[model samples]
Target: MKTFNAKVNVTLKKSVLDPQGQTVLEALHSLGYKGTENLRVGKYFEVTLNAQDENSAKTQLKEMCEKLLVNTVIEQYEVHLS
Candidate 1:
């Protein structure tokens, strides 16, 4: 088995409302930052996994994201393997 590095990014779906991101955007505007119309917040997870090959590692990582890391009902995820 080989050790692989995985990066999981979880973000609110385009149709979902992100109150936190809105709050941050308001705060930025209040702080005098201009030209910042919209803002979005997301999460990043870095993990190390053991797999027989890159394909397996990607599959496992994708499963992990879908099962536990991301909320499919309101969120979307992108996986990166290295």
Candidate 2:
């Protein structure tokens, strides 16, 4: 087996309101970052797992994303395996 690294990015769906993003945008404006017009908040996760190959790594990542990394009702997730 080989060890692989997976990077997961989870974010709220476009239709959902992002209060944290809004707060960050407001802060940017207040801090004189006038050029910043928008912001979005999300989560990132790095995981290392054992797998036989890249395909196996990806499969594991997909399962992990579906089971624990994403809230399907309101969020989306992307997985990158290396």
Candidate 3:
């Protein structure tokens, strides 16, 4: 088996409201960060997995995201592997 390193990013859908991100944006503005009108907050995960090949690794990663890491109803996820 080959070891794979994966990076997963989970974020709210575009149509969803992100209160935490908004709060952070407000804080940035208060801290004199200008021209930063748009911001969003998301979750990041680094995962290590053992798989037979790249395709298998990718499939396992997606399964992990779909099963538990992402809320498909309100959130989306992207997976990158190395």
Candidate 4:
């Protein structure tokens, strides 16, 4: 088996409301920054996997994302394998 590294990014769907992001934006505005606009917050995950090939590692990472890493109801994920 080969060891691979995976980077996962989880973000709220465009339609979803991000209260944390809004709060940050408001804070920035309060700090006198006027150029800030609609802000969104997300998560990042880095993992190591052992598999036969890059494809296999990616497949496993996808499963891992769907099963535990992200909330399917409100989040979308992008995966990078290296």
Candidate 5:
């Protein structure tokens, strides 16, 4: 087995309302960050796990996300392994 590092980026679906993101965008605009628009807030996770290979690592990471790390009803996730 080999140790792997995984990054999971979880985000709300585009169809869902992102109130936190909207609030952050408003704050940014108030702070003179006018160039920023349509900003969305999301979650990032770094995990270390043991897997047989790169494909296995990615699969494990994605399964983790689907089973517990993410809300499939309102959010989606992407896993990157190294």
Candidate 6:
């Protein structure tokens, strides 16, 4: 078995309203961060798995994201493997 490390970044969809992100953006502005914009907040997960190969690792991670890690209705995820 090969050990694989997967990094999954979960973010809100563009059409979704992110109240937490908006609050953070307001805080940043108050802190005098003028150049920054579009501050969106989401989840990041580092998953370690044992798989037969890279393809197997990807398939497992994709299922993990779709089934539990991400909300397909209002969120999207990007996975990076190492």
What digit string (tens of lDDT, one per residue) describes model 3 on residues 37-70? Answer: 9899999999999999999999999899999999
Error of 3 at 61 (Å): 0.7
Reference-based TM-score of each model: 0.96, 0.94, 0.97, 0.93, 0.93, 0.96
For model 4, the local distance difference test gives 0.93
Kindly state the number of residue pairs that clash in model 4: 0
Q: Report per-prediction Cα RMSD to one decimal.
A: 0.7, 0.9, 0.6, 0.9, 0.9, 0.7
The predicted structure with the larger lDDT, 5 or 6, is: 6
Q: Which regions in candidate 4 have their CA more than 4 angstroms from the true location?
A: none
> Which candidate do you rate higher for TM-score, 2 or 3?
3
Q: Count the backbone clashes (under 3 Å) in each candidate.
A: 0, 0, 0, 0, 0, 0
- lDDT of all predictions: 0.93, 0.91, 0.95, 0.93, 0.90, 0.96
* Candidate topping lDDT: 6
Q: Give the poorly placed runs of model 5, Cα more than 4 Å off.
A: none
**In candidate 5, what are the lDDT values of residues 1-82, reduced to their tens digit?**
9999888899999999999999999999999999987988999999999999988888778778889999999998888777
Across 1-82, the per-residue lDDT of candidate 6 in tens digits comes to: 9999999999999999999999999999989998778889999999999999999999999999999999999999999999
In angstroms, the error of model 2 at 50 is: 0.3
Q: What digit string (tens of lDDT, one per residue) describes model 2 on residues 11-49?
A: 999999999999999999999999997788999999999
Candidate 2 clash pair list: none
Clashing pairs in 3: none
Q: What is the TM-score of candidate 5? A: 0.93
**Per-residue lDDT over 9-42 for candidate 1, one digit per residue giving the tens place of the 0 to 100 score:** 8999999999999999999999999789999999
